[model samples]
Target: MPETNTARLVHRLATLRERLQPEMDRREFLRTLVTGGYALGMAQLLGVEDFLAADDGEVPIVTARVRENPDDPFSLVEQTRDVPAEWYAAVQNAFELNERLARIAYTGYLGSAVVPGDYASGTASISIGVSNEGQSAREMIRDVSEGISINTETIIEIEEIEDGFEYAEPRYVESVDDGRVPSGIACETPSSLATLSPALYHPDEEEAFFVTAEHAFKDEPDPVGHPLALPLDRVERLELGTVVYAHPGEDFVAVEPNGEMRPVSRIAAPSPVRVRGQYTRLGLADLVARGEELEKVGALTGHTTGRIQGVDAVTCFTDEFCRRGQIRWGGEMDLTDGDSGSVSYHSDPDGRDDDVLVAGFNNARTWWPGQSYVWGVSAYKLTAEHGYHF
Candidate 1:
């Protein structure tokens, strides 16, 4: 009779799993159960602590320890962190589960982001954004009891973006003003208008270029020939120069100067905002821990500040593939059409008041109903993916 009850309990668990994950097949679901609750994914299974010391229970993960490249994406630093064994195992299980489901891409799987919490708390949640067709909210709640932590977070619905930046009156960049060609001003190409970034140094090329969002272009990106111009007073346009390089995926276009104007390491604020350096993933996490906000100056939006929402966010909603090392911050209203190339920056803690460090580039964002935060690629990601720095 006791054996019958035990068997029944297992059957009930299997049935509950089916109810929760309607998208996963029975065989696949059973494999996931075996993978998560048993060997290959279990860290502290009952009576298994004999295998290793209590202090050794933490898992040394490479991915969690972001790449160690301060300059380029090619150099990988082999540093590891000691994460709680159980938490690491759970994260691994979640990754496997997400991977299996993503392979199927069920009817309404919008996207997913892994939100890592305090390591001591052994808590981490995967926020998945999906449409109504896949699984209902009630079923998902039940799955939580089984240690399947995937939150169906819905953000951004309307894709409407207002027109590009247009000045009520005419304005132009003056060559006479030193540090005038700084960030936060409008930079126009043949196709679109984008916010100008501070002088980005290409160590390998040994040159600096005026950078902006590549998507600001109407059609395809012109890497070498396209010129970037700034609107000004006497002359209709101040030519920055032809595009030296264009990274559509990273969403930055590096323009070489053709005229007398030179790019400076300053932001277009009433007071000087100097570019000191950039933040690592750890640095961004520290900001998140302290509940700090970053400020940005967009060509259209002008200036606005908002709290950082998530760090080391992997966004798969944009293109065919996924974009890792992204920072989600600010309100959606803080950014607009021409604001794509602007940067989010925090004041340097050790440097002077005017010195600031780059956080990330303001590109795409959430425009849905329930959610209201801006999202962008992080500077660390650019250094990890490509060797460019501001």
Candidate 2:
């Protein structure tokens, strides 16, 4: 071979090596992510495509449910866990399909939820609820989702609830400490009583709010005009705040704190649970896959625990517009009329003693005879739609 030809070949090889170095580095980082069993989602942060390749290997996924900085609710530090590649692919596909179903939101579409299968099965499904007049809609859903598995149920008319459905009296705020009030207690609206939710924080405005069910003030001509008053045991009622934002689609209201006693990140229960953060959509699905249960403290029902039935759910049973990104758990017995605004929660898997993550707000429950479950807007949904976090 001549010298010029040899030099040209060497240059070509060098150029090829330069192009492949970044790819090699990315693969090495991914391998570390698998073996090390943790990641900060650097790929997503950097907008690096092909970070996760299709191979018969493990992959890292976010499993942590808290932020590194509690004050900055949006600063979600990704805590990841390694899982089989096949399982990740299956779950990811199911999630995508679920979102598609939600977007379609066809007529008579009562609701839907995602149910992830175990690791060994590497499968997932969507549970769809349809009204009696939804046969065509059901066929349409089947047409759009070809390979995904779906379970369908027909929602029928429900009879009126029994007249004498008795419940315990409302719980009032006995006292306040450090100028802060604990959640899970009762607060009085102009029209009705409701349970208080944990402190809701908005990242954009950097403001904290005391939240409750918007429907509690339905009878009032102007919900925002009336103050949200906290009834004390023996003392005069203390005005906590007034409605700053009313989200009827999600069925919750955010009250701007007006008095010294503001909402705290704690629940008033037998064993007090501290609010750390909230679960993502996939996080809730993972809990369902592992057969985990959610607990809640309502003013009337007190503390109760129940298994998660579904996640990323959509419900159109009662309202004019469909409510998306909901969670269905427990049974109707877990919630009552006064239990509205109570939040569903679960123990933080990666937190200190008594730390819990907010799942969603318990707004309403099923009344039909054949079906029985409590449903509400998930915490992830609230954050995704309105930028509020617990």
Candidate 3:
């Protein structure tokens, strides 16, 4: 029997190697080996019997109980408001204009980021807008420096230059210590033209921010509990804790409250497809079915039905020991590096619109063969625990 088991194990290993060969690189192979060893060790200690028992196929059946509504035969009335033709036409025109402007702005912004700058001798090729046409390259660099100072002091460090222009090569900066000016800065500029833009001078200014959807805390000294905040605008910041369960190979980084810095293994991608209004309609069917079932059984006596209005990814961190898996949203949207701690909201009852409910925070992306998964923290759970209405 032992000989037979050994033969089976060898066959399995050979099959795994054969299957993995097509896409496996050195790093991937090493990662697989490590993960496989860990799994085997865990199985041996925990006993595979319980693990196998946990896989029993059991489908839950939901039963509905009837309930009588006190307010029977509630009148269903259509609320109507008349709009003047001129007002309607004006609104339509405004919408069209706004849409055109938005499209132009988005295209120009992304185009500028991807475009390469012209490299000239004796001067670095900097991005010049209509506003900065007359400014000298040196002056432009100064302005960029000032802007960085205003937002984050001395985050950009100028290190030694290599074969390429400053805009084309990575530039390193000294570590930010007490916001004081150190001897020098160090960083490598990407080949992209957007790197030269004053807008992208700050580390957080670039759209490509990393994100992580692991369990994190607001106030904690441990690396796993360290707070990571993303500046939304000039005045607002979205904060989250660190996730320890993230893939160690990812090289995640976070900023601390005391302005200290640490490296993490998992970081979330910043950009996410913002789902709002009609876009959230995709989940409406499933939500409505569940809601209706609850309503029929009087489970929704005080609850009102609301459609999902918006969805965005937020950052979370795992425990210090990295026992739990980090949670995140995985959707069709392209997420960037700096979007780790964004807040997603549903509808507010006291707000202008009452037809929508903010669902949950989108957390991470899970890539599959042909599709991706969007993971999110359920709003229902948050509301239940925090006594907040959504």
lDDT of 3 at 125: 16
The full ranking of all candidates by lDDT, starting with the best, is 2, 1, 3
Which model scores highest in TM-score? 2
TM-score of each: 0.67, 0.82, 0.23
lDDT for position 390 in model 3? 18
**Prediction RMSDs, each to the true structure:** 11.0, 9.4, 25.2
lDDT of 3 by residue, 111-172 (tens): 00001111111111111111122222334334433222111111111122122112212122
The runs of at least 3 residues in candidate 2 whose Cα sits more than 4 Å from the true structure, single-residue gaps closed, are: 1-56, 64-76, 158-164
Misplaced by over 4 Å in model 1 are 1-107, 114-124, 133-149, 155-180, 221-223, 233-235, 316-321
lDDT of 2 by residue, 88-174 (tens): 666776777888887877777777888788767767888888877786787788887757789988877743553234768777767
The weakest ten consecutive residues by lDDT in model 3 span 192-201
lDDT of 1 at 362: 93
- Number of colliding residue pairs in model 2: 0
